[model samples]
Target: MKRLILGIFSIICMVTANSVQAQDKGPEFSKLDVSPMDLAIYRNDKDQPVVRVIYSRPQKRDREVFGKLVPYGKVWRTGANEATEITFYQDMKIADETVKAGTYTLYTIPEEKEWTVILNKKTNTWGAYEYSEKEDIVRIKVPVRKAPNNIEALSMAFEKANNGADLLIGWDDRYVKVPFKTAK
Candidate 1:
């Protein structure tokens, strides 16, 4: 009985020591991203959200955004870090183009006076480096409107409209509005 007790105690001590050593090898947290991921949800009511956008917010940091860093006529991920993704809970008419209920990667082409907002069937992509026009579901042009004030970071929000809402994307000193209507 004495030997058995000693053996059990030894096993327990070994396990405890091993556990402590294993914990010492615990996870090393990665550094936070400079452009953090963000979300924008459009809800008509408390429980009924029609649209949700997941993207990253890139700061201007006193740099020129459009026609320079972003460049004209080139596809953009619509944000920083991972490509922007938009989800439609129901069928939606975006910029007068109909899209079925699903998720899509959002891209944009920044121009001098207008921007072409694109919705691609592909998802889980990083930047516009892998953008394919063949995968695009819809591409609509929206005129750039001067920002009411200088914006330091890329921002997106939904505003109530007659039938649905309008998605506003703004950065630096310019902004654009993309219309969204419920398919009726």
Candidate 2:
């Protein structure tokens, strides 16, 4: 009986030790991304954000951006990991076109002179690989302009205007502005 008790105690100790070791291993860090995630929010006077954009910022990394990494006339996910998402809390006119209050996936087609910005109904998508034109809610063509300086990471900024705002998207010495007006 003493030997059996000792054997049981030994097994318990071994199991406890193994469990402690496993606990000390911590969380696994498997996935790593060079480009990090970012967000752009435009708030109203009430401190409520009317527009929010969630996306990943990809660095230039000494590579060509527009015509190479993001080819011209091809649909781009507009970000790194997942499809860029834009949430509008209120109905607004984007580029003189009406956009209802909802969440939509923002895709882009970069060209040398102009860029076609698309708001698609499909929200949960990995990349532009699964993008469908039939699901698009709005498609606006905005002219691209030369940036004053190089923008290493992709960025979007909202500039407040009179009863409206301008959404500026810039990267790699180029930028495009999409003007929007809140629906009355």
Candidate 3:
């Protein structure tokens, strides 16, 4: 009985040690790019655009190619490891409505006609595999556009526009745009 107890305790210690090592590994940041994209949405508030989405993403692996592998219509986690989260410095309007500023998980519903961008209440989750609709904070539909060239890798870019800049998501060389307006 004494030997059996000692063996079980040793196994438990080994298992715990392995789990601690795995947690310390975190996510493989070296294998991924952490490019930051800056976004600005102008509001009539005249306080400079209070709404900004600091976005970033990793390049797609050959097997994880967008559209071809991710497919046209599906729920995308929007980023790697932890869900793609947005930090709102202040409140902003979506389709002329109000959304308080804070960190939020961004999910998307991609379709040929229009793309639905969801601000989910859930944060720090792996891919959309465990996504729950109950965690949605907001859902806004946006238009999709065809790219002139093929983008083999997934990318997020913030480009300046005449009115408000675009937070662009490009993959398989295609792109989508979601416009925001400030509440008067």
Candidate 4:
């Protein structure tokens, strides 16, 4: 009877030790994403914040990017993985609409001649799958222009303009500039 009790106690201790070892294996991490996230910011000459954008950059990989991989006349997340997000540090005018200082999801409709840039109130969205026109704060049409050079990765940058700054989105051989008139 003592031998039987000892055997049961030893089995329990072994099982507990095995469980601890399993937990000690650490976490299983996922593979790297093909499209990594990126950021773009525009500031006034006074060093005050004007605007900021967070988005993912998808590679071209020698394939036709626009009107094919990314279809025209459809709302794109403006990047990859998660929908692009834009923040207005100050009250700004997009097109004719006045947008208050806040964060918004940025979506776009790519076309051969023009692109419809949208700023929606929705935040923390994964993709354009949840996009709704009702939540849009502003919609502006920006003309598509030929980029001087090819950009293999989806990229965004701000260039100072007369009114404020132009947020340029470039990929492949095409690019678009969205104008923002900021109070700053």
Q: Which candidate comes out best when scored by TM-score?
A: 2
lDDT of 1 at 38: 90
- Give the poorly placed runs of model 1, Cα more than 4 Å off: 1-26
In candidate 1, what are the lDDT values of residues 1-184, reduced to their tens digit?
9999999999999999999999898788889788888999899766698999999999999788898889999999999988999999999998768899999999999998999999999899989888899999999999999998998989999999988889999999989998999997
lDDT of 2: 0.91
Model 3 Cα lDDT, one tens digit per residue, 124-167: 67778778999887788888788888775556655555444456
Instruction: Between candidates 2 and 4, name the one with more favorable lDDT.
Output: 4
Alpha carbon deviation, residue 97, candidate 2 (Å): 2.5
Q: Pick the candidate with the highest lDDT.
A: 4
Q: What C-alpha lDDT do the candidate models reach, one value each?
A: 0.92, 0.91, 0.66, 0.93
For model 4, name the residue pairs that clash.
none
Q: Which 10-residue span in candidate 3 carries the lowest summed lDDT? A: 35-44
Please give me the total number of clashing residue pairs in predicted model 1. 0
Q: Give one clash count per candidate, in the order shown.
A: 0, 0, 1, 0
Worst 10 residues of 2 by lDDT: 26-35
What is the C-alpha local distance difference test score of candidate 3?
Answer: 0.66
User: Tens digits of per-residue lDDT for model 4 on 1-184?
Assistant: 9999999999999999999999899888989789988899998888987999999999999899999989999999999999999999989998888899989999999999999999999999988999999999889899999999999999999999888889999999999999999754
On the 0 to 100 scale, the lDDT of residue 113 in model 1 is 96
Error of 1 at 134 (Å): 0.9
Better of 1 and 4 by lDDT: 4
lDDT of 2 at 27: 82
Q: lDDT by residue for model 2 over 112-132, one digit each (tens)? A: 999999999998899898899
Residue pairs in steric clash, candidate 1? none
